[model samples]
Target: MRRSIGETVILRYWNEGFEVQLKCQVEYIDNRTQMVIVSKQAEVLNIEFRNIYETL
Candidate 1:
């Protein structure tokens, strides 16, 4: 699903013996870069995905 700014997303990742539950805002979704940029108030976050193909 394509989320928008101020939307809360569910993030699940277990790494380094730690689990994080992050509620962030979707700042931008870049099709050219295949990346999802999020923001937590003042912090900017970047997420990357490797898919066979992307949808429009």
Candidate 2:
């Protein structure tokens, strides 16, 4: 699914050899690069669109 800015989503990634899931807000998206920027706990993350497991 296509996500837009300001949308709330769940982001999952590997951290410390463990899969971590975080609920974050979409801050920006680069369609050409297929990259998304999300903010969680004051941290901004640059993640690939494919890395997004799901949108909520």
Candidate 3:
């Protein structure tokens, strides 16, 4: 499914040697860059679609 702004999502990606899971609210999306901007509490994260293992 496609994600949209204001939606809450769980993102899973590999980091270090493990898979990390983060839950954040979607803030913005850049289709050209295939990037997603999301906020979790006080932190804003930039995520690339290619780095994502899955979205739940």
- How many residue pairs clash in each candidate at the backbone level? 0, 0, 0
What residue pairs clash in candidate 3, if any at all?
Answer: none
Stronger candidate by lDDT (2 vs 3):
3
For model 1 the local lDDT of residue 20 reads: 51
Ranking by lDDT: 3, 2, 1
What's the C-alpha lDDT at position 1 in model 2?
Answer: 38
Give the alpha carbon lDDT tens digit for every residue of 1-56 in model 2.
35457888777765446666888888988889988888988899887776666565
lDDT of model number 2: 0.75
Q: Report lDDT (Cα) of residue 39, candidate 2.
A: 95
Report clash pairs, candidate 1.
Answer: none
lDDT of each: 0.60, 0.75, 0.83
Off by over 4 Å in 2: 1-3, 13-18
Scored against the true structure, residue 2 in model 1 reaches a CA lDDT of 67
TM-score of 2: 0.66
Query: By summed lDDT, which 10 consecutive residues of candidate 2 come out lowest?
Result: 11-20
Q: State model 1's lDDT.
A: 0.60
Model 3 spans > 4 angstroms off: none
Q: Write the per-residue lDDT of candidate 3 for residues 1-56, one digit (tens) a residue.
A: 25458889888976666788999888988889998888999999988877788888
Candidate no. 1 TM-score:
0.59
Model 1, poorest ten-residue lDDT window?
47-56
